[model samples]
Target: MFALCDVNSFYTSVETVFRPDLWGKPVVVVSNNDGCIISRSAEAKALGIPMGAPLFKFSDFLRQHGVQVFSSNYALYADMSLRVMTILEEMAPKTEVYSIDEAWLFLQGMEKLVGWQEWGHEIRNRVQRETHLTLGVGIAPTMTLAKLANYAAKRWRKTDGVVVLTDPERQRKLMALANVSDVWGVGSRISKRLNAMGMKTVLDLANADTHLIRKKFSVVLERTVRELRGEPCLALEETPSARQQIVCSRSYGVKVTAKDEVRQSLCAFAERAAAKLREEGQFCRCVTVFFRTSGYDTGGEYCSRQGSMTCQVPTHDTRDIIKMALSVFEKIWLSGPRYAKAGIILGDFYHRGVAQPGLFDEIQPRANSEALMQVMDSLNQSRRGALWFAGQGIEKPWQMKREMLSPAYTTRFSDLPKVR
Candidate 1:
């Protein structure tokens, strides 16, 4: 059997973890730049405040209802995620982190040795006791079914945040209750098509003929059908592959028209991408810089501009990447347009290392470059202070707005809550 463990309303839940006053209170978290409501607490959901509602449209409504709002605190969220994953890795025989808030645990035949519901509740209780964050636990024979069981666990309050689907009869009952769109891989468009064909629920899709599903849809959907009927089609990846490219971009909080400000933003993005590349233990061979005026109302001749430059050798040094980013920015930076967003991409990663440099390659990596980068990374990761390239600018007027961001309570020492 496999078990899927997911945090309940992760973003808003994280907010409540460190703030005792927020317990049982209606809370919501906004997306980048505090644009829209992305996460809401159980109380907020009960009040019928829709997810993804524009904050400006519902600001008055939320305030009138005593709902708390906060900006996206990515630093705190990421640190909390790491803590939760660490706990799972220590408890489960084998764990696959499915997302920031979901993890898969493989129990194989161990379910027979322990009572299913007892074991599920054990995992749930441990996570809640340690992290002060509630979890929904679902146990089933297949990964897809386990995900469905998790869905049922979260909705049915009597489960007490845990659901086990070992019996075929119980699985079908829960599947029948779930809409087709609620299935693991099925989306809105696919669900609509299935609805038109009289398959409006998960049980309908499970009863589908494997051969017919394969021919009508795809091998992937066929596999999903078999998995729904107690066959494992997807297995856990012990090591997920690194991304082919790292792109860092953000919409400016305020309009930017000056070349100097755009240059600072590009440098900041390049540095962040380089730091990620190093964290992945890989090197990048190309750097791309891009900037654009608001596509909605930019009256400029060109709405966007981008250009790329390659390196003589793959490198993860931030200075090297920043230099290349500046060069590309110069080529694409247009004057007199109100820039609304800027970003940089670092691509062409190498693991086993790239081909040898040419005999006459004029530029070479700096001496002791790797050691120098380690120091910078160490200081930055601590979060107390960071050493940035002077080009990133001390006063970043073009940064994304996070006016309601909470402090990094778990990640930064200065933000730690006082006992009193």
Candidate 2:
């Protein structure tokens, strides 16, 4: 058996963890710069506040409904997610972290266990009590089914946040009731195609002929069909594969016209991307810098350009990456309309020490790059103030705005919740 656990409205729920008064209230968490609604509480959803709607578009509606709003508190949400995953790691020996808000647990020989529902609720209650976070538990024979069961657990309040689909008949019944889009790995385009083929329900797709699915779609979709039929096609990946490319970009709170502002933004972004490259124990050979003007502005010229530079040897050193980024930025940036966003992309990765230098290329990997980067990343992540390079200016006027951001309740020492 496989079970999937998913947090409910993860960002908003994390916000409520430290503010219990917001528990049953209409709440939403907006994206960076308070741009759009990203996560909404059940009550907010009931109020018909659409997800991804621009915050400015619905300001009056939110105010009229008394909907509580907050900027995305990444630090608080990440720390709380870690706590939930830690509990799952201890409870289930074999687990795969699917996302920041979801995980899969391998329940070997659990079919023999009579009280599946009881086991699921135990997980739910324990996580809520320990982490002060609520989640849905879906128990099934396959991970895909477990995922759908979890969706049902959260979608229908009657399930009380736990759904068990151990019986084959029960699984089919749930699949019949669920739309094709509700199936794990099914995209909107695929769902529309399935609807045209009269496979509107998950059960219809599950009953599809594997031969036809492979001929019309892909082998990947065929695997999804098989998994829907209770045959596991995907293995639990405990360790996720390292990304081939790393990108760190953000839209500025206000459009920046000054060359120094754009330069500072790219430097900071390069530093961030380099830190992530080191985290994966990888080095990058190609550095790309991209900048653009606001595409939505009708009165100004829209410009978007990117430039790339490749090093002879891969390096994870921030200074090396930042130097390359600025070099590329100098080449690509056009002096004109205000630049709204800028970022860096590190690509053509190599496992540390695996990047062989060309015979003629004199540039070789820096021997002390790893040690220097390790110390820098440690201090930056420690929540003590960042140790930034001079290239990244001290005053970052182009940073994303988060005026209503909640405190780092879990990650920062000073942000801890107060008690009377």
Candidate 3:
């Protein structure tokens, strides 16, 4: 059997973890640029603030309705996610982290040991007890069905927080009730085409002719349909492949009122990306920096800018990435406009410890490039932050502010929130 475990209102839940005063309040987590609602608490959902709805569009309404808003605190959220996953790892034998807030666990042959439904409840209860955040769990024979069951648990079985689709009849009812668009891989475009062909619900698509689907859709979609019907087409990767690219970005606490601040922010982001690249055992040939002005039309002037640099030699060196990112910022940073957000992206990556022999120069090892990186990594890890980079300095006054952020409830000992 397969199980899909999803965090309930992950972003908002992360914020509420430390700020227990937010319990039962209408809370919404804003997107990266503080642009829109990405995740909402149950209270916010009850008030009908639609997901992905632009913050500017409903700012007044949110204020009037007393909705608690928060900037996305990825540091707090990621640490909490790690704690949640750690709890699950201790309980489940085999688990795959699907995303920041979701994981799939293989639970084959466990039904005899403990009934699947009761086991699921125990898992959910344990998660809540350990981490305050609740989970919605779905169990089925296939990954697709597990995902469907998870969604049903969230949308319909609100009180149960867990759902199991072991019986064929039960699966059929869920498929009929769920729209085709809500299926795992079916995006809006595919959903529209399938709906046009009179396949509006998941059951219709699942029962549709396989040959016709292969002719219309790709082999991948065909496999998804079969997987939806209870076959496990994909096996969880034991060691999931490393990320092809890495991005570190954030909406400024306040609009960047000047070009120097923008460049500084970009440099800081690049430093983070470089550290992540080394952490993942990867190096990049190209780095890109992007910045955008606030979406809010308080408008004196607004502009979005980006620049990229390609290195002759791919390196994961923080110095190299930061220099390239700054160069990119030089091209993009405009003096007059107030900028809202900025990010650094490391792309064209290759595995670390593998250096390409330069066409111009023989592959000669730098005397201490790798050693320097190791020292830098160790220093940062030990200090829990940048210890040597006095050159880059702390963020500027106009930088992104997480003023209302909750303390690190799970990761940092000194900063952990106290339970009342």
Candidate 4:
């Protein structure tokens, strides 16, 4: 059996972790710059403040209800996630970290160690005691059921934070109770199509004819249904690999009018993408740059282009990626009118040492290239990021600003502010 463990109300829980007084109070974490509501507590949910609702729209309502609001503090949440993962690693002999706030433990051979229920309770209690973060756990023979069990535990099973869906009878009952769209990997479109076919519940989808389902949906989704029926179609990976595409994009605080400012935004995003690729020990052969003006601005030019530049040598170097990205930005540069956002995407990825060449460019000698990358990587590792760059900073003011950012309560030493 594998157990799926998830932190309850992750962002809000992280805030309450350090500030115990915030427990049981309505709390909502906002997007960067306090733009929109991103995560909310159970109390906040009761207020009917929908997710992604702009803060300005409901600011008075939230304040009137005495709801405590926070700007998203990723540094604090990330550190807490790391701590929670560490606790799980020590508790479970073999585990897969599913997300920042979730993990899956392989409990098949641990029957002799302790009762599964006891072990699950101990894990939950210890995390709460040490980290002050609550958890919901689900155990099952398959990942899909494990996910479903997790939802059941977190949503309905209030007395205990753990649920095991190992029995066939119980699985059927749970599937009846579970929504079709709530089943793992099934989205709204799939749910609509399934509902039209009279497969309106999780049990219906699970018990559907595999051949018919496969004919209608793709092979991958059909496998999801099979997995829901107790067949393990997906294998749990020990370490999640880097994504096929790495994107770094953000809207500027103010619209950029000059070509230099657009290039600046693109350069910054390219550097961020390159840093991510290097962090994952990966490289990209193609870099794509794209930009557009505001959607509402009818008078200005609105354009989006996905331009690709092949790497002379596949690289994770910010210098190389930035040069290619900036070159593409120059190609797409528009004068006079302003751009709202620009981004860079790194695709056609390979692991750090994996390389395949094209006919036009001469390949670097493996020994020299490896040595050079190793030295550069070492310098970058030792120093803080951006110790070296491809060129000077793009000639523009730093227009990216988080105007309503809160104090770095738990992450930074200098930015810490008085709570009361």
Candidate 5:
């Protein structure tokens, strides 16, 4: 059997972990610069606050409803997610982390030994008690079915956050009730096409001929259909694959017009991207810098420009990446428009130690690069706050506004919850 575990309302839940009074209250977590609503509590959803609704548009509604609002605190969420995943890793013999908020576990043999449904309940309860984060658990013979079971567990209150679809009859009943779009891998466009073909429900698509589905849709959908029928076509990915690209970007809290401020923003982004590349044990050969004006600004000339530069040698060194990124930025940045956002993309990756040497211009060996990066990464990870490059300026005028950010309760000692 395979089991899917997902944290309920992940960002808002993290916010509530340190503030128990927020429980049963309408709450929302907004995106960077308080741009839009990215996550909402169940009570907030009941208030008809749509996801992605611009905060500016819904500010009055939120205030009228007395909804608690917070800026996204990724540091707190990431640390809490790690703690929850650690608990999951201890419970499951083998597991695949699907996302920051979800994981898939291989529970094949254990289901035969113990009652899987009861075991699912125990996992849910334990996660809630230990991490102070509620999770929904779904157990099934296939990964896709496990995903569906998890959806049902969250959608239906009677399941009480745990659902197991071990019986074939129960699987069919659930599939019949599930919309075609709700099935994994079936996007809105595909669902519309399927609906035109009278395959409106998950069961309709599952009952359709596999060969016909492959011909009409894709091999991926065919696999989804087979999995919907309780066949396990996809195996658990125990290890995540290396990222093909690393993008670091953010909207500025304030509009920027000066070239030096833009350069500072791009350098900061390049440093972050390079740090991620080193963390993944990879080197990037190409760096792209992009900047744009705010789409909402009607008074100014709107413009967007981007440029890419190829490195002479693949490198994860932040200094080299930042230099190349600045050069690209200089080429693309226009003088007039007030820029609202800037970003850097590190791409064309090669695994460390696998980069080919340039023939004409031999790459100079920077013997200290690796050691310097190691020290920087260590200090940053340990939260010693002792390391930063001068390129990343101290006074970031264009930094995103996070005015209502909650305390980093899990990651910082000062932000830990107070008890009397």
Candidate 6:
């Protein structure tokens, strides 16, 4: 059997974990720079505040409804996610971390020993009690169906956040009630196509001819159909696959026009990307720098530029990556245009100890690079944003605005929750 566990209103729930006073209040978490609503609590959703609604447009509405807003605190969310995933790892023998707020667990042969529904309930309750976060659990014979069950668990209140679908009749009834779009892999386009073909419900697509679906859509859709019919086509990934590329980018807090400001932003991004590469135990041979004006900026000439450079050697050293990134940034930057965002991309990856050396060129090995990186990472991990490169600049004028950010309750000792 398979089980899918998803946190309910992950960001808002994390916020409430440390601020019990905010419980049962209308809470919404916005994206970077207070761009838009990304996560809303049940109370906030009841107020008809749609997801992704720009914060500026809803200021009056938010004030009238007494809705609390917060900027995205990724540090707190990431640490909380690690704690939740650790609990799942302890409970299940095999698990796949699907996303920050979701995971899939394989419960092979456990059906015969215990009641599956009760086990699902226990998982949900334990997670809630231990993490102070609510979760929905869906269990079924296949991963796809397990996802569907999870949807039902979250959608309905009577289930108490746990739903187990083991019988064929119950699965078909649930599928019949669910729209085609609610299925695991069906997007808006696929839903429209399926609706046009008279497959409006999950059961309709599950009963449709697999060959026709394959011919009309794709092999992937056909596999979804089989999985909905109680066939297991997707398997849990025990380990996450290596990333092909690592990108670090962010919108600036304000419009920047100076070359020095742009250079500092690029340097910071390159440092972050290089750190990610080293964390994954990989080296990159290519670094790309990109910057662009705000899409909303209508005044003057709008500009966007990107440039790539191949490294002299595959290296994960932050200094080497940042040097190349800044050099490329100089080539692509436009002086007249006001830049609103900048990013760095690290690609052409090779696993450590697997990079081939250039035949005719001499490459000096940095004997202390590994040790230096270890110390850097250790300090940064111990205290968030504790280490920095001199080139990144001390006064970061381009940093994103996070005015409504809450204290880092879990990661920082000074920000820990206190009782009077």
Candidate closest to the true structure, highest lDDT: 6
Residue by residue across 1-420, what tens digits does model 6's lDDT show?
Answer: 999999999999999999988999999999998889999999999999999998989989999999999999999999899989999877777999999999999998676777988888888788889999998999999999999999999999999999999899999999999999999999999999999999999999999999999999999999999999999999997778889999999999999999999999899999889888988989988999999998889986778999999855789988889888988887876787889999999999987777566665334447898899999988977764799898989899999999999999987788988899
**Candidate 4 lDDT over residue span 186-265, tens digit each:** 98899899999998889998988889988999897788888898998876776776689998887666777777677767
Q: Model 3: runs farther than 4 Å from truth?
A: 253-259, 291-307, 327-341, 356-366, 382-385, 388-398, 401-403, 418-420
User: What overall lDDT, based on C-alpha atoms, would model 5 receive against the true structure?
Assistant: 0.90
Q: What C-alpha lDDT do the candidate models reach, one value each?
A: 0.89, 0.88, 0.83, 0.80, 0.90, 0.91
Q: Which pairs of residues clash in candidate 2, taking residues 3 or more apart in a chain or in different chains?
A: none
lDDT by residue (tens digit), candidate 3, 4-108:
998999999888877778899999988765767899999999999999998879999999999999877777889889988987776677899999999989886
Instruction: Please rank every candidate by TM-score, starting with the best.
Output: 6, 2, 5, 1, 4, 3
Worst 10 residues of 5 by lDDT: 356-365
What tens-digit string does per-residue lDDT give for candidate 5 at 1-420? 899999999999989888888889999999999999999999999999999999999999999999999999999989889988988888888998888899998986685677887888888888989988999998999989999999999999999999999899999999999999998888889999999999989999989999999998889999999999988899987678889999999999999998989999898888888888998999988999999999999978779999998866789998889888888877887898899998999999987777565776334447899998998999888874477778778899999999999999877898888899
- Candidate 1 residues lying further than 4 Å off, grouped into runs, are 211-217, 293-302, 360-363
The 10-residue segment with the lowest total lDDT in model 2: 361-370
TM-score of each candidate structure, all chains considered together: 0.92, 0.94, 0.86, 0.88, 0.94, 0.95
Runs with alpha carbons beyond 4 Å of true place in candidate 6 = 300-302, 359-364
**Over 4 Å off in model 5, which ranges?**
299-302, 384-386
TM-score of 6: 0.95
Q: What total of clashing residue pairs does each candidate reach?
A: 0, 0, 3, 0, 0, 0
67: Cα error in model 1, Å: 1.0
- RMSD of each candidate? 2.4, 1.9, 3.3, 3.3, 1.9, 1.8
lDDT of candidate 3 at residue 275, scale 0 to 100: 90
